[model samples]
Target: MDQRAAIPVTLPRDNPTQSYWQLEPDEIADLRSTSSLPDKADTVIIGSGITGAAVAFNLLSNGARDVVMLEARQACSGATGRNGGHTKAASYRSFLGHQKDHGTAMAAKIARMELANIRAVHAFARDHGIKCDSTPCDTVDVVYEAAQWELDQKAVKAMQDAMPDDDAAKYTLHSREDVWEKFFCGRGGDESVCGGVSYEAGSLSAYQFGVGVLKLCLAKGLNLHTNTPALNLEKLEGGGWKVETPRGVITAGKVVLATNGYTASVWKRFQGVIVPLRGHVTAQRPGLDMPKEGLPGTYSFIYEGGYDYMIPRPKGSKFEGDIVIGGALAKAPADGLEEYGTTDDTAFNEVIMKSLDECLRKYFGDNWGADNSEGRIRKSWTGIMGFSPDGFPFVGEMPGEKDLWVSTSFQGHGMVLCWMCARALVTMMGDGDEKELDAWFPEIFKINEQRLRLTFRGRLS
Candidate 1:
């Protein structure tokens, strides 16, 4: 059988590795269009992913009214909803990449911003009652050691070297023994996290978080529309966007394009800019050794490990069942199932399923729960994020369009980056300095001066 045919969704589940919040199919939109938009508004935002929500939330918080949020699908169905529920205050693995490409200053600033996001999420949760099942558990970037691990450390130090003096305070360095005590004490070496960096952030329920976010937006009186895909988009006379949807037209003064990966056509030139990419995951019976419902909070990452994340729900400690997971669909397919070297996970395959089972077995040891077998693989999803030919993602104007901003291409790391992206975009669009932030921190965004042809375009470079 072809390896491509062996796609992980054997039972044909939906985004198998997704957590509890996303297990259910996305909620449908009720479109309070109980009435229509007043033909005009100061600003209108499209695509309701976390980024769009964050932008809406930030703008609302900043006292901007007449702000409306529209969702082509239900809120969060895009990357904001379909993403790994994992949340972090710092760039998890990409900080290293940030250091290499941008330099120390940018990298450090990105790191600190992540931490702030965690604080912001919790604060939002408490104040606004956005019940995303937010948690305070800190996450660890663990490694098994070796030169690669050290190089990752050097990236961290370079970040420290670039951060302002005050921002650098409270940074910690854990020894091998300390790492073990804090994370893997009494654990087997094969599963041991030899060394790691602790950052003050963890995962959240994406679906729940999205609902909370959307609900908040609704409360603010943001008009919403669903099942209304923006098929045709153009700039309006009053210096805004005119998006033609299947059901109605969305004309607004300022358009915040938050389509992570969907069918929203902004500019004819940006058609190929946001090509759709798919990612997958698998779930299994909890291992016997897996900590009970509420185990002390710890989100650990293993170097070279297939995937780096496993979070138990709040009930695990309170005595509710725990959800353990590892692995996302590995190889991105080239073209179709027969092709390789790309990410096309249309259906389930055995290769990923077996690999994930092995990872679960290894992490939990001989303790996987009996009868629990494997959780039913529920849904399969594909998200479209714009990718920068350069390794990192893009956040800024819509290539050739005026007054249009695009944030897409998350690779596999959208959760943390999305928030950072939204905040940065808002700042750039408005008059703001890094006042709340340190001066040593460099902005994470860079304008792509040269417009390259898109990957999905009919013609190639």
Candidate 2:
């Protein structure tokens, strides 16, 4: 697809909008491990979001030193910091389409792979002692549309029939008749009447996750330079590459592009393949009238023409009584496509914000925001996500660019994809063993000339 005509993706804008998660900044938010850019390094990772931090951490864990990471803005200042704080994987909602596109074998592989990614996130948090509010929770996919609910029910049955032995296959599905009882437990009143499937999921502060792991990597001699963008890249006469920046040029043996939405800025060939998509998220705190228990678990309002996801902050945490919700782009001005294709995320769209507000009120009832006595909307912010044409992230080495690896374009599912892909990418780099990598990564995620030749088909929502 010739996305060149659409809004072009560019470097992270200076003074980009701040997010609720980044309200209390971390010490390493703008840390530079070294006084200046290193003259040379064995590996240089770009974009210090979760992906870059994972790459650097895995490299150090595997005994590889002399690594450096460059970020255009503050650490974890991009989508990772601006996300809605949910790490949900695909369930029956997208199972049928995936099954048809990649056959049952790859489809099943993808399903299990996502589950593993979610588990890996929890394990990482526990192992590293990262207090990122990482919480294990169940996600209720609530479909308000009758037709879509029926279709979801059928898909759930099909998945159970196909993957009978898989542990995750036994997702508890609630029919429309029992949605209130199963989901709200009759607490939120008659207004709470939407439910479809409830599955295992997790939530965490993505900003803290990125920065916490990055601190561990820095202790192991990882040179990180924030506020430094890789403006231009060129192949050195020898075998490595030279990356130019306002600070200075740095040479590295291998370069990894962890710049999720802004990937096309450094690699022009990815102009259309890895498209930038803007999304909005809002944070709200419960008022005095609401119960302290609040909503039971995370939620996804699956409407016929729109959807919104929400993850409530853990109790007693810094943002204790707050909830972070994002989506409803379908209510945006331009069919949500124009909003998705755009690169700007400096402000929130009022139309979508209004829709999200209405959704919360409808689900929670009239007492939700009754004179700020229940829960009031605090703030709304936006962030850019990379939407892959094929609905999969572009991982592994660039098609023809040797030693140039990429782990971007996650289709707005970066939380579940970044850590696992980074681990597998580090393994592949340490040893050129395809069989080993095949065990960790699915074939659909690899980048190659064949996949690049295929036409682009927009895959949003």
Top-scoring candidate (lDDT): 2
| Candidate-wise lDDT, in order | 0.55, 0.80
Worst 10 residues of 2 by lDDT: 184-193
Alpha carbon lDDT of residue 264, candidate 1?
A: 28
User: How far does residue 300 in candidate 1 sit from its true spot (Å)?
Assistant: 4.4
Reference-based TM-score of each model: 0.77, 0.94
Kindly report the root-mean-square deviation of model 2 from the true structure over all alpha carbons. Answer: 2.2
> What would the per-residue lDDT of candidate 1 be over residues 196-275, giving only the tens digit for each residue?
67756666676667667777776776666654556666787768788676567767777776765442244444334444
Task: Evaluate residue 18 in candidate 2 and report its C-alpha lDDT on the 0 to 100 scale.
Answer: 77
Q: Give the candidate number with the greatest TM-score.
A: 2
Segments of candidate 2 deviating more than 4 angstroms: 1-5, 185-194, 287-289, 366-375
Tell me the lDDT of model 2 at 136. Answer: 85
